[model samples]
Target: MEETKIFLITYFAALLGVVPPGLVNMSVAKTCVKRGKKNGIYMAFGASFIVLLQAALAIMLARYIFDNTYINNVLLRAGLVIFLIMMFYFLLMAQRKRKEVEVTPTSGFRSILKGMMIGVLNIFPIPFFVALAAALNVHGDIEYHLLNNTAFVLAASLGTFTTLYLYALFFAKIEAEGTYFARYSNYFMAALMLILVVITFIRIFSQ
Candidate 1:
């Protein structure tokens, strides 16, 4: 196969990959709606930075990583717990908002830090590379040379950032609705995450 094709495949694969609705984009949407686009974009960039690294690692270690279902299971379980905690956090945020006290928007290093923290826990991107690998090597194993991996990571990061920013921007449109939306966006996100957690547990138990 030609090098350019491979690069394009990886790029489009990543762009399509992140199009799914998930915790990362949902978090960005929450921030963008409640806080601002600048904050959401910062978080998206930070998360994408970590996703680049995660994609590289998944490509390099696909066999060792994907072959282990236990690891994936554990990750899901941990994610469930994390979402539960976040649910409570947002509940508290809502309570605080009732008193008319302003919650500051996350910005600068803080936004990035929060994004990185969420991104680190977001290991689903590893599965994305596994799918990419399968597509790349229909009949044989993928060859992840540094150049190949670099192209993939760069493309995946851009894709991630693009999709996340789009989601954030969508929610930002909702922010124009008024102050009521701005105040309650966190609870909306929290409820969404809670539903996801319930669904995760259901799938885990079903498996």
Candidate 2:
């Protein structure tokens, strides 16, 4: 049951984390529009493959931080500040205009390589997962063991793929309604960050 909970938490985190129109998913959608769903799916697979590595690296970093009591405590306090910053950043993003995604055409296995390249360029996942791991650790929701860590990485990768697949599957609708979706998604992210801020603050004070 605990393992399942860890899996679900990490899965949903990755899923919702990618819901906002971003480089990878937006590229997937654009690929679907310009090339085809097949290519887009291929790209998602490639990106998800990289997510596996990124998640693993993040968990490893989180484990290192967790091993040091002083650092962990400091990070929790720092997390509170970071969460507050993220809240305002997302709120600002919500008010900004979203730009159209431009995709270059690719086909076959090359699409996968293209996706891999794009995934490599996206540097947000590692820190995001690290912070999430820290927060979950504080809540006793995650254990840094082999089984739990594996589940977390696998779930995160699968979650990313699922979101990208959905973007590919619904490219037309997404293209039509993307601005509104992104705006609201940013607002939602801002709200979520605020909640994290509160949680981090309480965790820090309680320690």
Candidate 2 runs further than 4 Å off: 63-106, 139-142, 172-207
lDDT of 1 at 108: 64
Candidate 2 lDDT by residue in tens digits, 1-207: 767887899999999999986657866765666566788899989988899898999888886754566865766776666667767987897788756533345666988988887687565687678878888788665568899889999999999998998888897455445545443666766776777677667766776
How close is every model to the real structure, measured as TM-score? 0.82, 0.63
lDDT of 1: 0.76
TM-score, prediction 1:
0.82
Model 1, 1-207: lDDT tens digits are 445656778777777777776778877876776568788888888898998888888777776656677876886788788888888887887777365423357656788878888899776687777667656766675576777777777877887887888877887776666367666767776787788789879967886
Error of 2 at 159 (Å): 0.6
- Residue 140 of candidate 1: its Cα lDDT? 70
Worst lDDT run of 10 residues, candidate 1, spans 97-106
lDDT top scorer: 2
